[model samples]
Target: MTEQAAAVVDETTVAADLVTQLEYDRYTHEDPVPDWRPAKPFAAMVGALLLQELEDASDGWLHRTLDADPELAANLGFEPDNPPSRSAISRAWSGRLAELCSTIETSARQIRQLAAERGSPIGGPYETNASEEPTGSSKRTVNRLLRRKARDLLDELQTVVLPAFELDRPDDLVYDDEELLTLEACLGVTGTAANGGAETYGDFVNPDPALDDPFYEDGPSGETPLEAIKDLSPTDIAKMVNQGAARVLTRAKPRLEFETPVMLSIDITYVAFYGEREELVRVQGAPEDKSYDWCYKFATANVVGDNVHFAAGMLPVGHADYHDSDAYPGKDKSYRVGDVVRRLVDHVNDVCRIRIRRLYADREFYATDVFSTLEQREIFYVIPARRDDRVKRFIARMNEDVDGNKQVTVKHDNAVYGPVKHGGTKSSTETTLVSLPPDEDRKEPQVFATNLDVNDEIGLDRRWAKKQINRYSRRGGIETAYSKIKEFAPWTTSTNFSIRLFHFGFAVLLYDLWLLVDFLVQTLIDVVEVRTKPRVTAPRFRAFLRREVSALL
Candidate 1:
């Protein structure tokens, strides 16, 4: 048995020092120490791992156990009311899995040795004898595996996924590969983030050599198919774009494992509109802090999970159709964000077939109508609290309370909403207001409004607050999703709302496929766990996708 293993088992008292030797062994190892720092104490994390080994529990059992039995957790050296979350443990384990497993193995041996010393040894050694070949051991093997996975994923995308994005065209204008040609052209521009007209395909992808098959004998001109696309209504384009996103998710869902009742995040994004086309002006809105005054607005709903992050639904905001402009004019009619949220939720439920567990939205969504909508739908939410006078007063009182300051940097109070006016009736909504410690990135202490229960006890308040905040941080992934989606979204200067919407939506479809490709590659690399970051980068995935698309031809 290793000395560090023996030391941990020999200590009878449960305190932080029980794993001192394990900490020493980590720093004194032959391999370079990891640059990552753990969120919880070193000893507390090690103790949890030991408990995990003892119980042989699943991934989320430890968190549930700790919360269910705080006294038992404290006896095991964890602070009462404050247990390390499952995600924290998983991250810590994955980051140092090789090192931690060795220590645990050594400790198991030491325990058996001590039992034998007392004249009754435990059973035979606890170890798996299975010898499976490492799939990712060599760079060549990894690339080969990745290519195979990519081919399978992309094949489905082409055959089943791309067809969902086909737009209706006049039969007289139709020809061989008309829909396929249009889809491929959009994808080509997206893959390279190219700007300008359909000629952007030739400028960026240079498809002359790649499209040399018989399908190219009577090849469509640069503006052959897409010129007709711009003639379609924005509603038609939006429907096709949404269908494409849903199709990719439906195809990937059976292959990938997703958490039950996936969490959803909705946020608004803007595309700067620079044009003098007066008729299209109705489709543009004034988004803040933009170089251009009029911009196209969009709302997107994305699945917020560790492994299965997919943008499932999208809505073109501030766009209206005037069917009867004579009586009910479209002049002063504006879109409500709360109504947008409701529609997005309905779209995911009815179209994507995803039952939402909770929603995390931007601060702009912190309105009474939004709260009413979510509460009516029975969906939990976490939104940044707007610093209105009532919330500001709470912050002031919290700052002056010295007794509360020493115990926890977090505090919570009930945020009661009106019996005033909601949804054409007098109604009320209630939620909790959480005041977190001053974030390093912000000047003011962070405050959030949530329907989730917050425990404000001595040892529990900090942990509960931190965990909630960490969960909220997952919403930031949607921003990253938008950024990566732009890499695949074709840049455009066209004032046609349909063309712009199609470009954005097609990019989202491609982005989801990229995530699925990376996910499949990850499964090939490690069947048992999911990594936070992708091994196959955006550019590499784009390369693989473009190659697969060419092969389909």
Candidate 2:
């Protein structure tokens, strides 16, 4: 402790001195110091804590004191009679301040214990043999604190999602909306499917047998949440879940530190369905031997980079419900791949409040309409090209046996292509295409379509093209993210689109939280080398959440 830290010992000079000591601790620490600037002054929080300690008041005393008196708030260094919001105060205390307070108090008590042991008798003879133990929430491990804060942040999603479906907590409800939402996240983190997992968790937490039934099971006789969810339309459910994802992006945007505009990746994922194909269900093509062909498809837009792959927006990809006779009964209602990209881009831009600089996608997004959409938005992108006749002709022009391994690079700056819709008009886009030599990953040549500068004056700009191609390779993170998203997604056999959509969306939310935690942990350990590798693995985070939330129950 320095002189500034020593000044915090006296109760009369506590709050301001405590702030000084905090500043001292930050400045004197090694590299990678915590980057936190509280919204409220630390002095006000410190003074409130000290006041509660002196008066032996309950947890509600801080807010009550600030609300009942203004003079004291001003004296404690809050903006004249304008105390911080209850949430702000709670956030401030729940963060690093709590650790600092614990440290300071413990250090002072240890000093007193040392004095008593040495026969100095400071503070009127402290007992050396007395056990010093933390009680209640303060006794929780660091993992518990982290899980509590994460779940608290995710609770905001419920406030946005539930009302979108016109849901509220009824007295006779089997589980409150928050509990169901947390249960959804719990199922996702634990990699268990819905009903069985819910029943197991309920058995541990719910003491009353009547209320311990799985509330997510699909049935007419049960009063589970699925009963209410089954009433919502597919559009309503999609909108509600997307709103929840947008809220997550809005919350995560502030934590990102970027030197360039964010890079985004858009791709579609399929969830296999075994039951009968109902409304909102689309047929996914597969081999004749495969059992399940019908599936629910969802498109997600994710930020793709070193340590920041958050699924920012998501939507279902299916044709409009026109009639029971034919899938194409309604021409105008079907959502195309281009429409998915445009909606996700606009939604992410509006909600995240950040300009998207580049977008990357797999060959499935190699259509002319997709290229035209990205170009129109002026967002640079790289999409692996489908080997159509024109693309194959360009690849055939290259020497077959160049450099003994048939590895030769080719670039075409002006290539025109179009899409043939189902009995609809075709549209074309003029873009650049790059054909690369085979490498260790694959034996065949890889072609990519992009608006990036990949041209060399005489031949392929090997260096520049290689650098851009390496950036395109970062899109692999999106696939890895999808695999991990599945890890967080609960196994569900339900064919109801609403339940499936909610489960997938909530799993994405948990995945984003897991990435956020890893990024934060990296910032504390090594500020520069972030997202290089995960500091907190998925299993560890899931375990933490499961233990903490179960303990809460």
lDDT, candidate 2, at 200:
54
Candidate 2 has which clashing residue pairs, if any? 193-491
Stretch of 10 with least lDDT, candidate 2: 124-133
lDDT of 2 by residue, 397-434 (tens): 65445356543355655555544233223555678877
Model 1, poorest ten-residue lDDT window?
121-130
Q: Each model's C-alpha lDDT?
A: 0.61, 0.59
Q: How does residue 189 of candidate 1 score in lDDT?
A: 32
TM-score of each: 0.65, 0.66
